[model samples]
Target: MTQLTVFGTLTTLSPFHMAHAGVSAEIDQNGRVRKLGTGTAKLPCTPTYKVPFPLSGDLAVGFDGTVRAIAEVPCLPGTSIRGKLRRVIAKRIKRHFIATGQLLSREAYHCIQCGAFSGDGIKANLTTSAEVIAADQQLFTGIFGGGPRLFRSNLRTHDSYLYCAETEATDVLPVIPETTALIRAYQATFAHPFIRRDDLLDFLDPIAPDVIENYAEAFESWQNTVLVTQERKALDRNAALEARAAKKRGEVVEKPEASAPTEKQKKVMLKGQSALEAVMPGVNFGFRIDIRGDDAQCGLVLAGIVDMIKEENFGGKCASGYGRMAAHLRVMNERQEEFPFLDYDGRKLLVGNQIKSYDDALESGLSQLTSASFEAIYNPKTEPSPRKGKKTDDHDDDEG
Candidate 1:
């Protein structure tokens, strides 16, 4: 049987940051050494966290005790890609089950058989682990395999390295050492510095009360409901503890003081600054995924990949518009002569051996996954309730 492979180039639509904890110390303009990392440290203004991009290796310290920059090669590990795809696929599967309702109890059994859905698919629990294992043998689980037995996944995702202009070949992903050689000086990643200001409302306080009445009310509500409630609770607990300690010391304690917002709290709420080392928008990376499965499994996996590209953001700081990527993908069988597939840009997919629009392709895959024939392989009717067996953990290694 020919194996299916999905190969692609993923290009960043926005700046992306994946922080590595390795710290580097360098002398600032003030001639004092400052450490850079995704950790707490004192900055010129205030103590804050600094986030740095994943480096090829930690910065080296010279014999003179000065820290120097090492070659930096930004990369996206396969684990991140695989983990996210599994989650998206699982979510889609659950939604499909929900959409079908009671129209197909047999199809619902397939989900129940696989323990991945957290019992949403279970109508009645099977008596034995062996029975559960037999019932769980569905196409999705068979391909992405994770359960008590720790079955190996049929899918293998390769680490994607940063793609430079010289490495335009997306057919095969290059290794880190090779990628480092291809890196251009101008293509080195840089951090985007930003200051977060929570004091915008403070400036508005000076405006006439009538004009700012709505804003004031909204701010007051948030401050009272969230910040004040939490802070007061903490303060009250501390005060009570102090009173208890004084009583133990045989000293008279005056009435405990009401909690007041501290100076540190004011500083934290007013202003903050940090920087994230990030790859610039439009940077590309080469990725590959190989799976030992039939067309049904291939189509399902393809649908999940498309969903991740179109709807989800990768890496860190997605809330700040980082990690958005567009995929330029191609799908094919290993023995090209046996099962031919066409190259695909971001907007299309292979459905029934023909290139189809994204929506149609997605629908086609989901249909097959939700079909009766697909689920019949693990039909609950075929299995009888066996002797009760020991419970087993469903956790499986992501790397597998």
Candidate 2:
């Protein structure tokens, strides 16, 4: 069985900053430390974080502190990829599952990217941990695994994409005794990590046992009501319109006059050099997308993803031109056949017998879909909590 495989490279055009760095101390007119900014105080440091996945032992004993070796494990979290892809999917299929129509989950403070339950691909309930272990058996749970749309399995971010991190040659060598050099002038930076199906399952293990306990309950109690974001609810235009109409009807309304809108400012915290670490440009990461079958829905999804890369920049700093990268897409069959989707500007998808790409569909536009669309999908209110299985408490150790 030939699945749809998409393999490509992501060439970073600029420095990628997944974090927000406040301007630290700056250089004054003279060669003295201004002492105002929150520059790190680690005494000329490099980032020391294992922010990526597929956790390794490379940083075992004295590697990072001694060698200051630049690691090549800046893996783009699978969740992040799912997020970006879903946004693209939402834009194309007119499905807003990625952004809108969210309900505060039963779990305290648990939020989301709006997800679909893959249901372990059984369309039935799983009663035991053994079943979960068994079900996961023929599954492809990698970053590009097409399982989400194929097996109907529920997945919350678990895949880790790949990236490369390099160390400067000068940093690798020491001044005197390689192991005795107490003096150094530089540090190395690394990327994220690459995770597999097993690696991502770490997030689900907590909910493993009773995941499908209330399967029917979830599907049954699901609601289709659309709720705007907390922010939107405050600025509802319909309420304002209603207030104006009520006043025109000779009814005294208590609506206040509109005031100038003030933009909310983010508070910046000052941190010393201990807080700086990021991915530099000129780094490339390769990706592979494999789908179970070659279907139009898949084709539309691919097109939507391409459009996202074309319209928006990658990573976090688009406004500052930080995460700009190129995505090349193509479709292939088991017979080693390849369809260069990128070469076409969605024209090929448009001329098909049916609507192949959502670029033209009214329902496919993301802006058109909102909390209302989720009404037709699954309800977050009904989603089973990530916490499952036997409970543990202080009383467990007490005698009856």
Candidate 3:
């Protein structure tokens, strides 16, 4: 939406180069030459200005005959836009002149920073173009709502430029559902147009439609699995608690009651028990595995056990540490599909009771353990060896 203009000798520079300078000027207005000042002793002589222009008004013409004036031009958004413009100019120059062996002046071939092009000329140009392209790809992809890292990477390297450019060139393209929703939401909230529909459709079409659909479906499926799993776990836990309470009740009965527990008596007993019982014991009481502690005391003790199993190589024929832990924990508690707590030190700490996978168990265990506990467990008693003095084979052998 921003704009700037550059005035320079057309004979001396390419139109693309002029365009690049114009874009830069728009972004950085300070680059424009404002006034004709008196030349100092070190660089003596220009005191002139006010010359007749071919069209409209008088132009500020220096003693050297170079005219300076503001030219009207449109610019891309932000610094990245300037960089891309530079890259486009550089690429065009390289392809038309440099690669074909056309002779160019030192001024024409000079690097802007060093004023020379003696080393890695082609490589430098390519690298600059690549970097700029990468940045532009990232910006455009973000504008589109979503994109893959690989696709973005390829776009930057010119590998996917044709595909992206073609999409950009199209009209009335299909859009992703998420992107469409986002556009609608944005329009509703802002009460103004921010992203053009054409741009949205262009970006969306390049990204495979099926990939987006599948990703959405997969995410929903995972959410459903988690919800169902949690429900089933709650039901099983409630049944287990009820069974334990019933057994305790049976043991407490020393003799058959003179009268069986009537409905009123059962209601009274249940109310008394409810008053004493704590709701959500899991939330009220929990343990942590301190991974950084001695014996590797962890937030979840199950993870700690898994760590032990792995270190000892003790879980039958299974080579994977995770697999071994899952197997061993399953044997200990048939109801548990995996260890709920990760091993910490020699014991397993409770992380969660319904973790269904080893990965989840490990994560839950680590989270429960506090940083202070970790420091107490794993913090070295001795000071670390100085970097300069470290030279022993034993030092090299240490994993830390």
Error of 2 at 268 (Å): 11
TM-score of each: 0.54, 0.40, 0.14
* Model 3 ranges off by over 4 Å: 1-213, 251-312, 316-400
The residue-by-residue lDDT of candidate 3 on 184-301, one tens digit each, is 1001110010121332223445554455567657556754664465445334433443454556667543332232334533332222211100011001001111112111111122
Which residue runs of candidate 1 sit more than 4 Å off their true CA positions? 21-70, 102-137, 164-182, 199-270, 336-400
lDDT of 1 at 363: 71
Question: TM-score: which candidate is best?
Answer: 1
**Model 1: colliding residue pairs:** none
Per-residue lDDT of candidate 1, residues 1-400 (tens digit): 3376777577777777765544443223442333432223223121112222222222234324555454234677787788778777867777886787623454444343443333332443433765444333445765675433333467898777676422333324532223233543225455454656544335544554546558768777755565555466446644664675677789787976645645654444344434555677766777788877655566667777866776647888899887877666666667653222333343454333442443454476566565453344333344434545633344344635
RMSD of 1: 12.1
In candidate 3, where is summed lDDT lowest over 10 consecutive residues? 276-285
**Each candidate's lDDT (Cα)?**
0.54, 0.38, 0.25
TM-score of 2: 0.40
Winner by lDDT? 1
* Cα misplacement distance, residue 379 of candidate 2 (Å): 5.2
The residue-level lDDT of candidate 3 at 320 comes to 21
